[model samples]
Target: MACSACGSDSAIVCSLSDEYRDYAPADAAVISICTHCLTVDPADATSVDTGREVEPDFSRLSDSVPTRPERAIPLVLAIDLCSSIATNRSAIESLLEEVERAGTDPLLVIDRLRADPDVEPAVDLERRRHQLEQLLY
Candidate 1:
């Protein structure tokens, strides 16, 4: 794959672990950016270990042991915008509208968006607007 920043042919795929307890997952994929020019090299991306602990199983415990089941919580989608002219507002609004129409909770929507190459300093307002339009309406 070509670098998103410098258009370099070299790139690596990388994996990452979720950091937050709420949104954390077992693992995730990330593209490595060039250290020299800060260019995102998708082809050269590599996975990085986050060292997160794995969930333990307690089904086979002794009869005297006390065990609690994991709680199931509503899903909350996370939206992020890149430098392109786009945002997540429209997507969220459209999602809310769909939920209302379907008479379902917004938690049913499990979609999330993030910057492809990891935008720096955040995307501009115009870009956010465009992103919202593209994602939602």
Candidate 2:
């Protein structure tokens, strides 16, 4: 089956893989994983959030906007997160601004989000951080 996170045609559900690395926990089901993403560390740029099993509880961050992630990589992550969370258009526009902006490393953007208090349970931020790891990185 295709990976819900990266659209890769290599996603597979492993009953033997480490549960600690599972992405989602759909009710009574185990986690699904992709071959490519399962290896990339979330701390790395080319990372896919392999262990996510549920929709992140980002409701608390509905109003906690992240800083504009400029450059290519950061921009991609920001845009992906915005789209995933259905952030307001105005906020998106502001986030796209390149004022004093610079590089595109995914970690930079992840770090920015890490600093934000809205992203509860550090794993939530990691989930979004590598949301596009397959496509971009």
TM-score, one value per model:
0.24, 0.25
* Candidate 1 per-residue C-alpha lDDT over 1-137 given as tens digits, one digit per residue, 9 for 90 to 100: 55455655443333322321222122233434332222322222224344753332222211111122121111111222133223434435543344445443322222211222232212232344444444544
What lDDT score goes with residue 102 in model 1?
A: 45
Each prediction's Cα lDDT score?
A: 0.30, 0.35
Candidate 2: Cα lDDT at 35: 35
The deviation in Å at residue 62 for candidate 1 is 54
Worst lDDT run of 10 residues, candidate 1, spans 68-77
Backbone steric clashes in candidate 2, count:
7
> For residue 98, what is the lDDT in candidate 2?
33
Instruction: Write the residue-wise lDDT of candidate 2 on 56-133 in tens digits.
Output: 222223223223212432233234334444343333333334312453344555456557553332135566555434
**Which residue segments of model 1 deviate by more than 4 Å?**
9-14, 19-28, 36-81, 85-137
